[model samples]
Target: MITVNAPYAVAVHEGNDFTANPPHTSIWGLLYAQVKQADGLDYRNILLNESEMKLKPKRKQDEIFSTFMQEAEERRAEDIRLNVRHPHKVDATAIMQDVMQQMTIEKHNDQSAFCVWSNKEVQEILELYGLPVDSSLSILCVEVFGQVNNTYEHIDDFAINKSSLIKNTEKEFGSEVALEYNRTIDVVGPQPPKRPIDPLNSHLGMHRILRTSPLTEVPFVCCTD
Candidate 1:
């Protein structure tokens, strides 16, 4: 592919939300090499790729880390399981969701941002250029497949359900920031056959303000991917 073989091309998600990915419309300046060297190794071999670090090493820990957007995922999952402090837990979840909504970022400037599904930018590309760019919900399903508890039970139903998540997230954050949440999460599903999105030798963040949040701040970048 053009991106994988380029001198230094890399695919990076511009936001911190679940479906965040690159928009189709923004002109990416990175060369194929950079994308290949940087974001290339990401989806090479399913068993040996990003999922290896995110799942096999410590499945449970990884699950907790990813389920709620990391950092707070574990505690949130535990809280849900135990049903301890029900009122407080519910309140905390609301607060957390709100915080995350406020934390989702958008890609407009050149400070090095990310892209996602359904962004105005992507829709523009699809409408204007006819490129196939993934939506945030789809991308999230692709990258974090194992993180969700019942993905298999209804993996086929994600696209339909994803719209619901988008609406809920938008309502949670209010209008001013809803766009960012909508832009960050990609809904990758319909459970299509897994094909190589990007080729070998590649690679691939956060903040607050909803507007002020930084999406490229990756906690850990594995050497393998």
Candidate 2:
């Protein structure tokens, strides 16, 4: 019986009352705030009403501080969880090469400015150019960047105890099982079998898993064609 635009619908449903109160699209207003915040001209401290319009005559110091602090805290939390808030459009490989060239100075820059790569950036670069690079070298590069950035401050706030892994198992099975549990966690598992060069199934090539028959000690390939 009643049909309005999507924006109107959102405004109505998201607010306390569509007629008396309405929610403002603060995200749209964020562009303006970003310009001000980045420009270091955030003196006005525009306060949004329930309808999202700027409150007149600017906000008080306490309100401005409170709002800015809350925003900063939220952004910091997001950066920790996400690693990178904004993805630079620059060529990552080229940047990595340049950074690697200026390793000493670049390391300092990363530490001071938090120039660490985001998870998305890392994944994207690796997917594009990972095949030629050795896995160890790739890991080392990331480690160096991580050390410089120290971006895990939020995640590191919570420490994980090694004992927590096997606490329950230790009670039930004693120290030996707990030691084994630790070993299992620390030890590397067996690697997959090398894929044979089967021209017949060349297109279907994959890292094959080794499996053994119940009655036999011999192993056979158990993956792909």
Candidate 3:
């Protein structure tokens, strides 16, 4: 939690799978929380990408998006459990319903979505600035590409590595199916490069972990020392 000093900005990003029924995203910004003052502690939340920031038009949008994300998360968890347990009796319909219930609970928990700062707008803005849809180094992408060319080339090199994904699936399912998947992935390409972001900078100067400044400050309070 960063202290709100005067005013600052924060970057916004959309959830990876915003195409889902309920959309979700994130807000990256500087938060300031000031110490004691006449007007109470100062607080400020500044949008870094103000130009491209998209505020949700309808209040229900938040509800829908929150529900979708929670349900998806729950379903993902269930999938993991099923994969691990290898249950003999599988009820797809029941699993879906349970996940839906979880989504509904999430929606009810925050109707106003007052705490949600991320949305699709931010994601679009980031994309406009050439940030890849699925990038791990979001901050660096914003700082380097967003500042330089405003277009960071997304490079993906596929190479063949240990067939963990296929092997795992095959173990859970069976050898025949796993072999089919393995063949498919092999057709796709090879394993990824050692450093994904290494291509971003050809000539390295100083590799610094980009970060937003924590703009929080506490003023001096004097009583009787």
lDDT by residue (129-153, candidate 1, tens digit) is: 3333331211111221212234323
Q: In TM-score terms, which candidate is top?
A: 3
**Per-residue lDDT of 157 in model 2:** 18
The segments of candidate 2 whose C-alpha lies over 4 angstroms from its true place after superposition are 1-65, 68-161, 188-225
How well is each residue in 1-225 modelled by candidate 2, as lDDT tens digits? 101111111213654444211111111011000113456856322211111112122234445445545655676677777778563333444444544445444322211111232334433443564222111111100011011122112122112544564687799999999989778655533333433232113322332322111211112223321
Superposed on all Cα atoms, the candidates' RMSDs to the truth, in angstroms, are: 20.4, 28.8, 19.4
Cand. 2 TM to true fold: 0.17
Q: Worst ten-residue run, lDDT, model 3?
A: 149-158
Top-lDDT candidate index: 3
Each prediction's TM-score versus the true structure: 0.17, 0.17, 0.20
RMSD of 1: 20.4
Name the better of 1 and 2 by lDDT.
Answer: 1
Error of 3 at 192 (Å): 9.0
Better of 1 and 3 by lDDT: 3
Clashes of 3: 16
Off by over 4 Å in 3: 1-26, 30-48, 51-162, 190-225
